[model samples]
Target: MHEAEEAESLLDAGLRALFAADLPVGLALLDRELRYVVLNPALAAFNGVSSEQARGRSVAEVLPEAFPTLEPRLRAVLDEGAELRNFQVQIEVPSRPGELSEWEASYLPVRGADGAVLGVLVQAVNVTAQRRADHAMRRSEAHLRQVLDSLFAFVGVLDADGVLVEANRAPLEAAGIRAEDVLGKPFWDTYWWSHDAELQAWLREAVQRARGGESVRRDLLVRMKDDSRMTIDFMLAPLRNEAGEVVQLVPSAIDVSDRVSSEARFRSVFETAPDGLALVDPQGRLSLVNRSLARLFGYTEAELLGRPVADLVGEGDRARHEGLMRSFLRAPEARAMAGKRHVVGRRGDGSPVQIEVALNPVPSAEDPLVLITVSDIGERLRAQAQIQAALHEKTVLLQEVHHRVKNNLQIIASLLSLQSRHADAGTQAALRDSQRRVMAMALTHQLLYELNDFSALELGPYLRRLTQLLHDTFARQGQSVELRIDAPEQGLRIDLQQAVPCALMVNELLTNCFKHAFPDGRGGRVHLRAACTPQRRVQLELQDNGVGLPPGVRPGQGGSLGFQLLPLLADQLEAEFTLFEGPGTRIAFEFPLPPVEESGHA
Candidate 1:
């Protein structure tokens, strides 16, 4: 009936009522020595023991595995009368030996009538399922973040009010910015668009549109952290909830600066090129024409577009041009059309203008196109014609000069021959050699005029003719010396500068063989070969099957005039000359040929 006794009785009654409620919460009361004094059925089940068995048992005896961690906290509460709130722990019960569970517990100090601590009251709840769910949620969020960061594109999440909530690592790193720089700020106010007032305004409107459940996409020029500008293909799409309400905005962007720059450069080149260029569609109709092309045909760009390409040509060639265009469309290739014949284009005023046209195919699978370049060659053709006429006049004058010089040399040779008839024996021989030398010079001029190429002549035919002339003058009447000439049908060409010296050299060598090798009517053979070597040089070899040179008489060291001239001619040709002393004298020389020019004449 005392006041303190009455309060303790009421508290006992409330504890009994709660324990009998059979709730899932674990409740217990421990004595000062941390022994179980009383416990509900739930707490007894948590400890894997009955209430009768757990009562009067020590805390370590009941939960030995968890006692080490819980002993300090329990002592703190019991010794200091402290109230420990919401302390979490893990415990494995005797019934489920390896199965551990999580718990949230609170310990309150129980007081008696004199306000002294009597026992400790414990309240616990199982929170294992909740902790597991929270762990799973964190793992899922980390996985999503990793996936977003791996993307090469910029990605961001915005609240319904257009405030930036999340930005992927790609965009942050690309702009050299941290997430803190833009998170929780308005999307239009971020570094990407804030540099441009007009763009920011447009982006704000676009965000509003997305919030209204509309998707907006466009190419925008955005500024980076370094103050550099780049183009991005940006899009803002709405993310809606189950109730069909827009809850957030997802903004994504991909960098497209390089592609846009390339397109711009191509456009500039197409418009500013000097050649009259036109783009023709697969139908052979002009789709685009540059300013030069429009001016060349005396038509405006508007007038030229969609016009049949064949219409620009003369009427007589229109049908043929159309046919050729059709053939080219079937299998496209790059070629020049003006090389086969003169291409005459008709201007707007029906005047014929000479043109050179080239066609190049553009690679496109869906839409095939041809790039046509037309050059107005009217003035060029006139200039070329004038040059050709002048060149022809000079060629005729050169031929006439060569012919008159050849005739004058022959007259001199005849005079030498007539003088030799009345001179002494030695004088006659000297005059005959002099006459042969003059004749050799004339043969070169004759070949130049006959071949109509004053620049170069084929060495094979030149040597053949020169050798025949020497044989006729030096061979004795009774000697039967046979001559063999071996040379390619083509490719052994020497320029005029080398040809004259080459002719005189061959004349001297053959004349020496005829006069010295086959003396006293002795029959012999002379073989001459000319070929192109792999190292791009001409090789000439002359072998005679007769008495060789005298002992110790090397070529170019003999006392005769022919031997003296050999070294000079070889030097003029930049040739490597050598001789082999054997039964028959073998003389060989090689010299580099000039590089052939584009005209294919050399």
Candidate 2:
């Protein structure tokens, strides 16, 4: 009996020494009866009990919630002398009841010298955070796929082996194929390039280059599903892993076929036109002149190149025409000869000829080139002199119409303001809202009358002024709010169709913030940010740091007039509004900038 007691003490010492090494894993030892013989600090903490309480206690008694699953595994280790590796189980600790946490457990049978199972040794590792991370990663990947599917450009993803793994909706539509037809296939074999052998080879080379960690860009002609041939700007880029290895290839294609065709047509017209055509650079020098222009001025193309356009004007009209040319270059647009007037042109021989010139700026905003179209009105000038008087009368009438429209709108605004004074408070507010709406439209017309560019308006200054007007009108006693405008120095150009609605939207947003945001003389800051993205999308952000919105009041759900009109006006601009609630309220909207409209004199 003395020897047996000494051996038992030695076994306990050995078990304690075995668990002494510092590690995060929970360690425990149990007897054949599935009772805890030893529990280390880690294991004791895992069970939310003291080691003394766990000692000699059965697994079911200590952890009832985990015993249903744990008892079977513990019994198996004892009965079959088997070891279970990396078995996962969920358990609730007594210290934190009802909170289920996952743990990876390993069980091994402990044997005596006679090869009989004495107990089971258990090791457990917590994996709850890792499991949560895996779930979140799956959700993020699904979100990424949704975003890719919504894009308009053709996009495809290829594995390291250059096999197409996934593609967006546009690529499937462009190739006239389903997902199964392209996925898992070699990228070059897709319908987009398979029709052309040379194109297929080029794409294969590009894919290899991308896999080799070099990006490749090339223009390729592809036949679309509609049987229309399109020139696409194709690009392949390498997607790298954390180790900086190219793990995938991302390929994108944009159709530039229409732009190419348009450019070709313009080139043909510019070169083969019968009339004298000259493109004057921003520096007042001729950059390009057609053969007809050179012949009309009695000089070879080389001789006339780089000559100031004023050099070709006759002595009598030189100074005035040069000044007119400067003004046209400054703010150039398509304009015919004002009043059908004629300018005298001097040839290389010093002889003069009467010419009717039409000046227009190149349509591109970046390239400031003036196109001078010269028509020899020498013969028709005398016959059209009487018609010129009538044309002048029409010009004056159009200007008068614009001025009268602006005045009439202003009159309506003034009448609304006057009527609001005599009404009750609610009616006064309604009338005032109507007055502001009228003023927004009136301001747009006022700008049109002043600018004479009836087609579009500069939205940046217009928004600033409108906000200032709103602040001045609605600011109450003892409340101070700073209205700040954050926009690019170059203002956004909005067409007349969208200008009024955009102004009204700004007005509504500002008015809403002024009325409701600051209550009982509270002061804060309001910011109006407007900018145009490189993708030609307009972004508008109106933020105010004041009392946040009501708990559940959303944009389209509010009952006030401002809320009703705000969404309606945003719809008119084709913009989607999103509301962000916080210590303040932020309303943001982004929409594609309206395409530049091609128009003529109305």
Candidate 3:
């Protein structure tokens, strides 16, 4: 073979091998006709034609519609007379799966020999997968674009160089930027701000990580087109080539202004909580201890972190503390974790202090965790001591006052008793009634001085004491009565004002029961019960198994001083008064329990 024939033969062989490879190759050969002297199987198979059909065809013969830019590209190659590799082009071919014709092509150029013109070579790689992928990617890009358009958020994409290559309509419109003005510009160049360094630094880190094959997402403050910057949360990724080298960055952005403000508010509340707060791990160690908690144990957070919670509890309290932690892990929603409870915490010196603890289990404290609030009750204890001192002084003063009042009342009773001896029957009866009233009031003061719960008097105990006093006073005068006082175990506290009136009313009732009902001098049983009903009304009933009320006058109804006092006392108590003489004489006084003067019972 001559050198030229030999070269053509070698060139044809090389072209065959290049197209036979799966990597997609195309070739075009020309003399003066711009025809294909040789075409590979890849180009032929992709075109759905035989090599015979392609060999003699011009660029316009095989694809009439592909000649627009293609003709120009071919002419350029003809004019330039040089080889080109991997230049991108778009062209349409017959469709598969009954869709429109799919697009395909290559970067076209001329294949040449030394010092001579050859034909234009088209390396038509079947870039269908990449093309479809790009189409799908564009559809995805359109979807994101739609979302970004409607939201109030500022969204944008950045290249790896901190340049704002593209922005959504929202941010662009908000910044008053013309669509064409800011494209392909650095983000910081559009606006100047103090936080530019922060944005740039973090974004650079994200780019570096993206380049290294890791995904990066962060929140940052970015400058806007209006020279104002707002906080935003952004996501970025490095777009890799087929060789996996990062050539560009694709990013998504969202505004997080509200989230940042909300987080700041929540943080303020968490840090300034009045109670000692801590995050105790399920393993019994403390993961986080707040400032108040550190102060509670006289240690800094560094000293308490990772330390077992037992170190801050007394030996007796350690087991209890462990049990609580276990309970938190098991149910977390128990009331014990929600309500306050007395506890003991150990100081740095290993001494214990009283505390009231309220615990709440969160899904996460550092995102998820259990929260404990320990209130130091040491000051409360001291206050209680102070209260005890005051109570002691008040008791002494009250006792002295009671003694003097009792003496004065007794003196009046004694004078009445002494005067009743020298008077006529009507006068003597009046004096004796007045004496009973004095004695009733005197006895109440004495009871007040004796009991610690001085705010209210227990009705049962008061009745029993009064019945005994009445029985003792009248026993010698043929007025013998057996008094039975039946009542519940609970006591009621009545203030001194209520106590005096109630006592006087009781005294008169008992005196009348003794004086009139049992004229036959028979023994009797009195049931004195105090009950608080579901409607929050309090009742005191005085019933007897002795004789009923005398004749036409009922117990609380008419003519007598004893009956008259009932209505006055009822009015004083804001009570409904009822007196009936059914079996014996049962008198019940019901009242809406007054707003507690000082809490009725401990």
Candidate 4:
């Protein structure tokens, strides 16, 4: 009986040691009333209490926040001898208030000697971190799926065997098919390439290559949703793993139908162009030549390609042509090659071909290229030479006509002078006036012929000469009259239409100043000024410091021919003729300059 007592004490001590063992999992024992009977340090800490404080406390008192959930399960284990394994629960504890933590727990009934349940044993593990990690991974996968589906290009993933597993939204919608239509099928059996058996076979091979870590790309023709063919820039590449092994195949494609069509159109236009066209590289070598250019140089397109451009030029001009080509490549722009001059090229037969060349620079990001247009101008040059010769003959004939006109006027002036010698004084004055007028017209023709331009003559020099002639004709031997003329150094010019009338008007006005202004050998100074106005008209002013005009003697109303001719000539020129009241007669007039097309060189 003493030994039995010692064993009972030892057994109690062993039960206490077992419950005190340090472990990460929480352990506890509850009585039939759901009161704490035995609690480990971990289980007491999970309830926010010490073991000594919780040993005799009810579970509702120690963990009030979790009592509602734990009481039912604890009661089941104690009264019905039920056992639970791996049951998951979410609860709040005193240690972390208002925050839920996840736990996985198991409960087993503890039986007495009569097989009746005495208490419940509990085991629990915290699984909050693992649960949170799993939730985050699911969110990331959803985002990645959204991004892949939003792309415009056709994109897909295939297994190592080339069976399609995933496809993006763009290509699926473009073909008016759902993902289920193509997914799980072999890549070559998809709607895009299945229409062409040969293309499908090629695609199968390409997929195999991609699976072997090879990248394949090509421009391929594929059937579209409308059953029409379209061109695509397609690529198949391997998706590799960390070990550098090809794990999956990735297929991508972009629609390139418009680009292919544009290239075809450009080729057609280039081959059928009428002008001789050639493309020259920065090195002055012919990179490409059209049919027209090959024919012009008497060489086939293949024969001209890669040939130096200078080789086509005549031997004498080859060196100069090469230098020009180099200069053009340095600073390229669109321009004529030789201006108006013809370039001489040597044909394949060694014959000379006169041609006009135009140069245009093609834009490039790498090296400069020149587009040269060669035109055979042999016939054109011949036509131009004939035109120039004919023009020269016509000029000579016009000059002769002007010389004859001047001679006839001189004859008339001589005849009038002879008549003046035999007439009365009044009649002699009239005859001399007519002769002077004839001389003025004759001088204009004489200047035109001398200048070899019948279009126009210098007004300043013509006026100076005419005035000097008048001064010589009218100035008396004892008279001391002074003459002053002001004009531009380069001289103002008027066409024949205005020049003839202007000369006649000046002759009349100056004759009046010489004949009527100073009388009986009374000497005076005469000034004539000519200038261009700001309004682009010509301004002329004739002033004299001689006896003023008589009262009431208005110009153009007088009976004399000179006065009568002034207004008529002014009317013909459409000029503004004004007579200012001053110390002497001041006559001013202005007329519009000819349009640029009608104006001539001075």
Candidate 5:
């Protein structure tokens, strides 16, 4: 009963009292034989037994489900005097089927007065709920990573100091950078935008503004690893805690490079159009005009911009033009006017010139706008007037020439007729042929004088009239001689160079058919055809039932002047001529048609 023994006894009683108290944690003491010598009420409850039933029994009998794991730890503490701290254990019992309870247990060797190992003291805590919560937190973190990485927009999480903590996949991929190059670094110092020091300073200001409880949004040009820049709609939003203080800054951005480039291109086209283009606002004022418009009106662009559109119209038409402009602004659509319908544009020098205009309305946000395209037609009108005057003068000259020539030829034919009356029979026949040839030339000049289109002759009408004249000239020989012409619905036209040769050939063919085909007062029909093929070739076919062309007298081999002239005319036209022998004579020729004249249009 010395002082030290008394202190020991006091300490032991206090330890026993503390262990017996009602607590959530279980406490137990085991003997050197790995048997439970003492256990509190909580330990007994955890083992599904009473405290009295747990004392002086082996650990196996008290807690059969926990004994296998506890025996080794107890043996170490008893034999080697070692201490086990916080060893995790899974507890199961029959009452809670298919459920495992987790516990953290600590085994410490208890010492006696002589420092000898006596038994092991065990302390355990039920950690099943805490372990489940930790596992759920890990799953939620992985799910959040999945959601953030799936977005195409650049998204990042930053601390209030503008230090990047987490970033999604897009920013890293766009800049061709690795996550290690951005994460945990200051946002402005990242490879996506670190090249520009001024931009970085501006970004820092935006971060400060976000930290001060305000959102910051801006258009930023961020450079990539390859030195390519991109326009981005960048935003930084503050995330506040329950106390309404900003704890984090969330930065997000979307690439707007294409939109920016498109706007630039559209602006360039508006300013550089070739025509005199102007944009008029709903108030009838010119909002914009290109360089062409300024030059056309003899005014600087600054002088025209913001000016009323009525200023460009003639003084007499200003009121009417302004009224129409206002009316169009109400509900505008596309409008066009032909250049033939002339309008006057008052230049800056106060002179008027012919102009053509088209107005088209563009869709707008608030006020309506019209696009005006102006074209000056002054030179075109002047050129047309000059052409008309020159053509009239040429017409008069041609008519005078034709009139004199026709009169002279008629006089020659008259002379021939008078001389034939006095000459011998053979000489009279020669004089008569000369008269007929001169008469044909006179007829061509008469047709040209009447039509007056010197460039081309209407072949259908001209041929029909010529044949009629020829038939009448030979009517004294026989009244039963017939003439027929086949042509297209629209009469064919040929240039004068082509028409002259064609007329001569036609006259010879018809004359021969009439003079020899039906002799002795006999009569027959003669056919003439003219056609233009789709491939731009002209074809003429003439035939007659004229005694089968007087056997052995082919087209080019005939001894008569008319027969000899046929091949010469065909060669002049670069044509292919064929004569077929039959009950009726068939003659056909084809030549390429001349191209239509396009110059000197009036």
Candidate 6:
């Protein structure tokens, strides 16, 4: 009787130890009707059932609400003697507090020592956060659909296999097909344009990208049922399950007919205005001419339609004309055509007069049919000359204002300096710091005055000057130290406001490095490196090989005003700051550099 009691005590101790093990959930069950023989308190509380409720009852009976898809999954594991393993399950209890969300789960089946089935063991992890993220994404999509409906362009939604499921009114009508007729049909089947192997390949890649959980938007031309081409902006995105199975697709189409027609009208007006229109083709043969060309050259409209536009352009400026055309081809879509260079012309009398030419290429049946619209600009040139002179006067006035503002800043700096010489020690120190800050920004404007781009500065040169300013401000106070800056080859252009934050940050960090990083009168080297990654994250690293930070300085924790302001500035720039503690302190700052659109002012 004593031996049996000892054996039972050992068994109970082992069971308790198993339940208390530091696993995700510690539980076990028997195969007989899937009854739970033991469960940890964690599992009990997770399912809101007690150990007593769990021990005798089958898993299905105790938590049917939690295991809606339990039976078949369990049988598969037992029948095959294989682990059921890491399958996800989601169930919505009718009385649960919120929306139903998919939760990930794990399961294992237990067998006897004889290798026979015992029961299935289960572990569940709530992925409600991930599920909520998915739902939030869905809500965002719904919001986008509402916005798309408000646009004038047609929109469409397509499935994985290329069946059109939904479309806005514009595209459906433009395709000249009733919604019912196109329903359930292959996307290409009713396409008014003939499909080629190249287009077939393009569509295949697009579908593959969408199925791979990526979204792509591109311009597509659809030949309408009436044989007219309609350009559309097409977007494709993925719809998938957790298992990565592509179930459906949502496509949006925006008809760009109005934009296309507007371009066409602009081309017509520019080419047919009461001026001679001509173009030099790729082979340098002047091939294009409008009806105005016939009237200007005293030739019949039919005769001059395909004539070498050279007939109206005389020989003296022919070489210049060709050169101008070559240069224009380099940037065909420049805001305006090339300046009206001299081109020779002949009339019914075969006379010559100076003519100004403005050539713009309009996309047409012939690739880039350049329209060399010639106007006798002798009068207009004089008028433009007068206007340009007036514009120059206004620019000079603006420059004078900048000059006056720059002088005012100089006056403020001089006033601060004079006051510092006659003030208390504390006031003197404050005035000197203010003067240094003013000089740093004053140098930026001085640099801008000599350059065209004032809104942004190159990282390499900017950093060089900034550190130089710090060195000049501090090094002159009988302080000896070395500062080094490493930056990428191509400059990272930073906006003016961003420049201030970046400079102030570097200034504070360096001041700390200078103040405490070295103590034994040894030369200290401070390293600064800035790089922009392909992910658009800007990484800025500052490190010193000195004796690391002083023990009393805890980086963001109970430090001075500079440390507190460092985090606040980081918050302003939306940057992440990290400090590594070691023999030498290393600090890294990285974040998405604000995009061009997010910049408030220059």
Best by lDDT: 1
Candidate 4 pairs with clashing backbones? none
Alpha-carbon runs more than 4 Å astray in model 6: 1-290, 295-311, 319-407, 519-522, 552-560, 594-602
Q: Which residue ranges in model 2 land beyond 4 Å of their true spot?
A: 1-375, 379-398, 476-478, 489-491, 597-602
For all predicted structures, in order, the TM-scores are 0.63, 0.39, 0.52, 0.65, 0.58, 0.43
Worst 10-residue lDDT window for candidate 2 reads 332-341
> Per-residue lDDT of 1-602 in model 3, one digit per residue for the tens?
59989999998788777656655454445544678777776676666667788778776777665557567767766777644555666565442333334334443444444644566656665567457768999999899889878877566666667676777788677566675676776654554233467656665676677767677787777666557776777777777779887766776667787889988996677668777888777676778777888887899879989998778878887898778777776666454356677878898888788988777887634443577788899999999999999989998988888888989999999999899999999889889888888888998888877875556676667767776777788887876577666655454555667777777777777777777766666777666667777776768788877678767875456777778877788788777878775788888888765556455453
Candidate 4 to truth, TM: 0.65
Expressed as tens digits, the lDDT of each residue in 34-77 for candidate 5 is: 77788887767666678787788888876677678667778889
Residue by residue across 455-546, what tens digits does model 1's lDDT show? Answer: 88888888888888887765545567999999886788888888878888888888888888887888989999999988879999999999
Clashes of each: 0, 0, 14, 0, 0, 5
Of the two candidates 2 and 5, the one with more favorable lDDT, higher being better, is 2
Q: Which ten residues in a row are the worst by lDDT in model 4?
A: 333-342
Report how far residue 419 has shifted in candidate 2, in Å.
Answer: 2.1
As a TM-score, model 3 comes out at 0.52
Considering TM-score, where higher is better, how would the candidates rank from best to worst?
Answer: 4, 1, 5, 3, 6, 2
In order, candidate lDDTs are 0.87, 0.83, 0.72, 0.86, 0.82, 0.69
How far does residue 24 in candidate 4 sit from its true spot (Å)?
28
Q: Distance (Å) between predicted and true CA of 546, model 1?
A: 1.8
| Model 3 segments more than 4 A misplaced | 1-145, 148-170, 178-206, 214-220, 233-392, 414-432, 472-482, 523-525, 545-547, 554-560, 581-583, 597-602
User: Cα lDDT for residue 486, model 2?
Assistant: 82
- Sort the candidates on lDDT, descending order: 1, 4, 2, 5, 3, 6
lDDT of 2 by residue, 1-602 (tens): 99999999998798778776555778988898888887777777767898899898898899888789778888889899889999888888674578888889899998888999999999987566446767999999998888998888888889988899989988788767689987899988877776799888888888888989999998888877876677988899999999999999999989888878988998789878988898899889988898888988899988888999988899999899988888877777545333334889999999998887878778764777888888787668776886798867775676677788878988998998899889999998888888888888878877776776767767787787778778888664345899899876454777878888888888888878888898887788999999988887789999999897898887667877878787788888899888886889899988766675543211
Among the numbered candidates, top TM-score falls to 4
